[model samples]
Each structure stands twice: as C-alpha cells, then as structure tokens.
Target chain A: MERVPVLKIGDILLVSIQIDMEDQTALQLQEDLADRIVETGCHGVIIDISALDIVDSFVGRTLATIASISRVLDAETVVVGMRPAVAITLVELGLSLPGIRTALNVELGMALLARERDFEFKDIDDDEDDADEAVVAAS
Target chain B: MALSTDEVGRFAGLLESNGDALTTAWTDAVATLLRGRLSHAELHRQIAELQKGFQSALAGGAGDLEADAAGELRGLLSELSNTRARQGFSATETAVSIFALKEAMLTVLGQDGDINATTLRDYVSFSAFVDRAGLFTFDSYVRAREELISDQAEQLLELSTPVVKLWEGVVAVPLVGTLDSARAQVVMERLLQTLVDTGSPYAIIDITGVPAVDTQVAQHILKTVVAARLMGADCIISGIRPQIAQTIVALGIEFGDIATKASLADALRHVLRKADVNAGRRGAGRRES
Candidate 1:
C-alpha cells in the first residue's frame, strides 16, 4: 500500500500531495494525517495541492473529511495551491468543500493557519465561560 | 433538348472560334446588370477569365457540361460568388451575372443567321447548363454571407468581455450585451485565468454595460461568483441599476452571499477597503517591528 508522507515543520504538519491520488491513497492519507496530528500534537496542517491537476468528487470528499477530523482534533487545516482549472472543476462537480480553508500558496496558507489558531485559542476561552455558566445552572 | 455528339462538337468549335466576340458580349451584358457597382476594369478582367475557363471546361467534356463530373465550371462559379459576397453584392445580382452569359452566347450564335434545329438543340442544352451554374452561385453566396456574419459576431463577443487588473490584488470585468450561455462561459474562463495570473483575491464584475437582468442572466452571474469563490477569491457584482434590482427581486432570484454594488466606483471602494485591510495588517506588523 502506498502512503503519502506527512512532514512536521515546527507545530504544523505539511502534506504535499504530488500524485493523482487513488481513493485508497486518499482515505489512507486522511487516517494517517489524523494519527500524526494526535501523536505530534501539531496545531495546524497545510496540504499543498499545487501538483494535483485533477480532483474527482471522491478526492474532494476525502479532503473535506480530513479537514473536519483535523478540526475535531483541534488542528487547523488549510489546503493551499489549488489550480484555477481544478477549482472550477470542483465547483462544477458540486463539491465546494465547505469548511475547508484554502490559500493561493503555501506562504499565505501558513499565515492563515497561524491567524486562525490565535482565534481558536480565544474561542476556547469563551467556551470555558459558557461551560461554567451551564454548571451553575445545573447545580 | 440534349445535343447529339456531333452537335456537341460543333458547339465547342463555335465557342473557341468566337471566344473574343463572346467575351466582349458577356462583359457588356454583365456591366448593364451590375450597374457599375464594381470596378469596370476588374469586372472585365474577371469576365474574360471566366470565358476562357468555360471554353476549356466545355472542350474537355466535348460541350457536354453535365458530364464534367469534377465540377470544373462549378469551382469557378463558387469563387466568383464568394468574391461578390465579400464585396457586398446581393444574391440576385450574383445569380444574374451567371445568367447574363446566356444572352451573350445566344447573341453571338445569331450573328451568322437562320436558326436550324441542330443549332436550336445546342442552345437549349447550353441554357440549362447556365441555369445550373447560376443556382450554384446563389448557394455559395448564401453560405459565404452567413460565414461573414458569424465571424463578426465572434469578434464582437471577444471585444465586449475584457478583464482588467484594478489594484495589486483586485481585478474587474465590465460586461456588455446579453449574458447568453456561450458568452458567459467565455467571460468565466477569461476572468478565472486573469485571477490566477494576477493572484488577485478580489474580483469586481461590473454589469453596468449590460442591458437587462432576467432570471437566466442572474443565474450566469451566480455561477461566475461560485466559480470565483472556489478559487479562493471574493467576487463583488456591481451596476445594479434601479430597474434591474426591481426585476431581480420580482423574479425572486437570490444572489446568496455575493456582494452587489450599484456602480463601479462603489465596487472599487469596497474592494479597496478589503485589500487595504490585508495591507494595513502587514503595515502595522512592520511598525511594531
């Protein structure tokens, strides 16, 4: 079985998909990505898809799945470097990949992820206050 | 009446022997029909060439014009019709040019006197041949005219849709004419390609030049906005004239989350604000450093 290598740079996991991924490879990558996020405690994941020329509905779904699981694991996922043609194709295919963040390049994606992480930390603080209010009501 | 082989032989001989007289007569008849619309010198030259070509084509088939299956004469007629079409000649005028040859041939044949049955048979066969050539010319003319019209239409479509970069990270496309599906597809591709080339995060689609907003037009705009969004760029649709806005609302056409402005300047202002926010953030960072 082929596996996409996930490299960690600082607290971010970088995954550059360089091949036309089969469904199995995409699913496997999604699982592997989640495992790495948990094991390494990465705060963000940037998937570079500049080399991905074509993406079908299955691949698009897998990307959305990966992003959702990463968010649940408290990791921000930004898929960067989508070609204009691929973007058009995805939309025409009715797969807008909602909730999956994207950027023009890896540099911009990194900045976006960093900024989002700051917002997420602030959100966590607000959630704690809401949790306290719920506890008092229950008591 | 069909000509016997001998009658065909004599007709071919007469055309060759009287080539100059037949050409001059043909040119004169065409000049009257054309009414000096084309240059006389050029018209004469073209008529002379046709006379020479017709004689050769006739001789090759032994005056049996229909037997020349390779369409040697028809090729010449098509060329003439195409030229006339481009020169703005009407179908009637083009077809009449081919018919004029019949009058010229009959006049030349009568100069010698007394109409005999054999000569009459040859004349009838030649007249049928000329009629066939005239119809062929009309067919070619219609096709050529249609091609010319379509070519101009395509050029107009290209001229109307032009994408321009307005700011460092903003591009604008001002559209004119109806947003038919073909034109919409072209506009979408050109705008998307420009977005990628400029790496612009913002796009302003100005519909001020557009005439009306119907349900289909609204759909085209929505599709373009969705496609742009998928490329990670925000789109602002401008030029919502009062009447157009009313129509859109009446039609219950929803634009969803895409931004709409009343004018290009307003759209520009909106784009500048968004672009500046990113720039301002970087500027603030530099100041802190």
Candidate 2:
C-alpha cells in the first residue's frame, strides 16, 4: 500500500498526501502519520493534503481521531491547505473534522501555534465541573 | 359380485352422497380429541412445563434449538440483573460521597479558622471524583457547603450588606464562591435572563460571598453589567470585601462607568430616588394639563 510522506521542519512536523483518497489506503496513511507524530516528539504538526481531490468518511474520521489523540499528548495539530472541492465533498458526506485545527496555509498555522503557546491558558474549569456533575447524575 | 346394473349405479350414487357426511364426522372426532389435549388450562400447564425444561436445559449447557432459546432468555435476565446491581451500587456510592463531603465540611468549620483554601480545594477534588463516579447526591451537598462558606465570607467582608428591591426586580441573585470562567459565563447569562424577564431598570448583585477577585471574574462581572445596561437595566455591585477591593486596586483592573455601591441599600436608594424624580416630573405635567 502506498503511504503519505511525513516532513519535519524544525519543531513542526508536516505530513503531506498527494493521492486522491478513494480506498482504505487513506485511513492507513492517517494512522501511520499519527504514529510518527507520537514517535517524533514534535511539538506541532501541519497536515497538508492539498493534492488530494476527494476526502471521504474514513479520511475525515482518521484526521479527527489524530487531532484528539495529539491533544492528549500535548502536541498541537493543524490541517493546512485543504482543497475547496475536497472540503465540500467531506461536508456533503456529513463528515466533520472536529478537534482538528485548520488553517489556509502552513505559515498561518505555525503562527497560530506560536501565539497559542504565548497566551495564558484559560482553564476549562466549567467543563470539568459539568462533566463531574454529569457523572454524578449518571451514578 | 353379480348385481343388477341399476342397483350398482344407485349404490354408487348413495356412497358419493354419504362421503361428505362421513368426512365431517371424522373431522369432528379429531377436533374433539385435540381440544381435550390442548384446552386453555392444559395449554397453560404445558407452556409452564416448557419454560422449566428450557431453564434446566440452559443450566445443563445443552446446545440444541431449545437450548439456544433458553440461553437467549438467560442472557436477557442476566443483563437486567446486572443493570439493577449497577444502579444499586451507584446509589450507595452517591450516599457515601454525600456523607463524606458533609463530614469534611464540618471538620473544616470546627477548626474555627479562616476557610483554608488548601483544605477546600482537596474537598472539591474529592467531591468531583465522587461525582465522576456517578454520585449525584454529593454534588448538591458540595455546592451547599460552598454556599455556606461563601455566605460567611460575605458577612465578614461587609456587615452593611442589605437586601434591596432595585426597581422591583423579580429575582435577586447573591453570588458566592470562586467565579471561574465557566461559572462567570453562567452568572452572566442568568443575570441577563432575569433582567429580560422582569423588565426591571436595575439589578442589585451582592457579591459579599466572593472570597477572591481574579482578572477573569472581574471581566465577567464587567461583561454582565455591560450586557444588562444594553438591555436597559443597571447592574449594581454591592458587598465588596476589603480583600477583593484591595485585589482589584492592586491589579489596576478598571470597571470604567459601571456603578459600584458599598451596599445593596445604597444601590436601592439610588434607583428609588430616580423613580421618584420621574414620578414627580409626570405629576407636574399632569397638573399643567
């Protein structure tokens, strides 16, 4: 199976895919990229899939999972330069890339990552409380 | 064997006619036998017997069609039993957590010192963990304890805190506890909603229970006040403890044009005086007319 290539730029890692996603290969590529991101110890990652013409459910779900897992590891992930057609296709398929950060280009994504680090983190205390309350109510 | 042709023909016709009656009689006899064997009471007994057999077959680990049906029933029963057991466990855990929180609060109060932040934080964490484990009763208990501490803190902060009917507002909310971003957001929404519902020109918010004032809390308060003003209501901040005041001044946080009264009574007086002035103006106009 053909796989996407992962590129490293200093502390930021870039994963780029050129193939039109039509099969399970796309999902496999996503998993491989996620695994590499964990092993590379990169602080930030930018996924550039501008070359792909179509994005389907498997690809979208994989990206969302990768983004969520990256957050758990304290690594920031950004999806960059998504083609308009691919974006529309994904939306039409009712596939959403939740939890993944998106930017028009890699430069902006890197800038955002830097700014995020500089800002004082707002603690999600309210969310934690709500979750606690929900748990309690469930019990 | 040597019969006349007419006699044989007549005999054949008689046999054909009797065929229908004979078939009917045979059907009736078979049906009667079946009814005796499968009467309502008898069928009920047979069904009960089948159920017992199924249960035994399942227990004996038989794997035929009958056993499969029994296995499915057993699975369903086991699932129901497990769910009930889990529910019972959760209820018990909630009760235990509530008790623990109450005990912790009593112990802290018994010390007769200022509310220890560290101790309170520990209790909050414990309460949160219990809540996550599906103990909801403990949540209310924890909230109540926090409210008690907040009430005390408010009293200590300003003795002159008064209940004020600012412009006949329907609901007066006395906020207590540390206002994090999320809590602040909730407070903001609640105040705005109350203002919209009552259509009051003024709302007196007694913040005497607040132990600390952070930048986030200050911003939230400002946002609430501003939003209320936009909706044609004034938000009055009252019962400012000395420490909170000191914190605000030290941090150089600004409230801009928002009104901050020392007490709710003062805030109420301000609104009532405005109402009186408006009423006086209307009376003068009426007299002239």
Who wins the lDDT comparison?
1
- Tens digits of per-residue lDDT for model 2, B44-122: 4432332343334334444332345345534433332343333343334324422332343334344556667754654
* The best candidate in terms of DockQ: 1
In angstroms, the error of model 2 at A126 is 57
Candidate 2 Cα deviation (angstroms), residue B264: 1.3
Question: Model 1: DockQ against the native?
Answer: 0.29
Candidate 2 residue A30 C-alpha distance from true site, Å: 53
For every model in order, what is the iRMS?
A: 2.7, 20.6
lDDT score, candidate 1: 0.82
Q: Go through the candidates in order and give each one's C-alpha lDDT.
A: 0.82, 0.54
Q: Backbone collision count in every prediction?
A: 0, 2
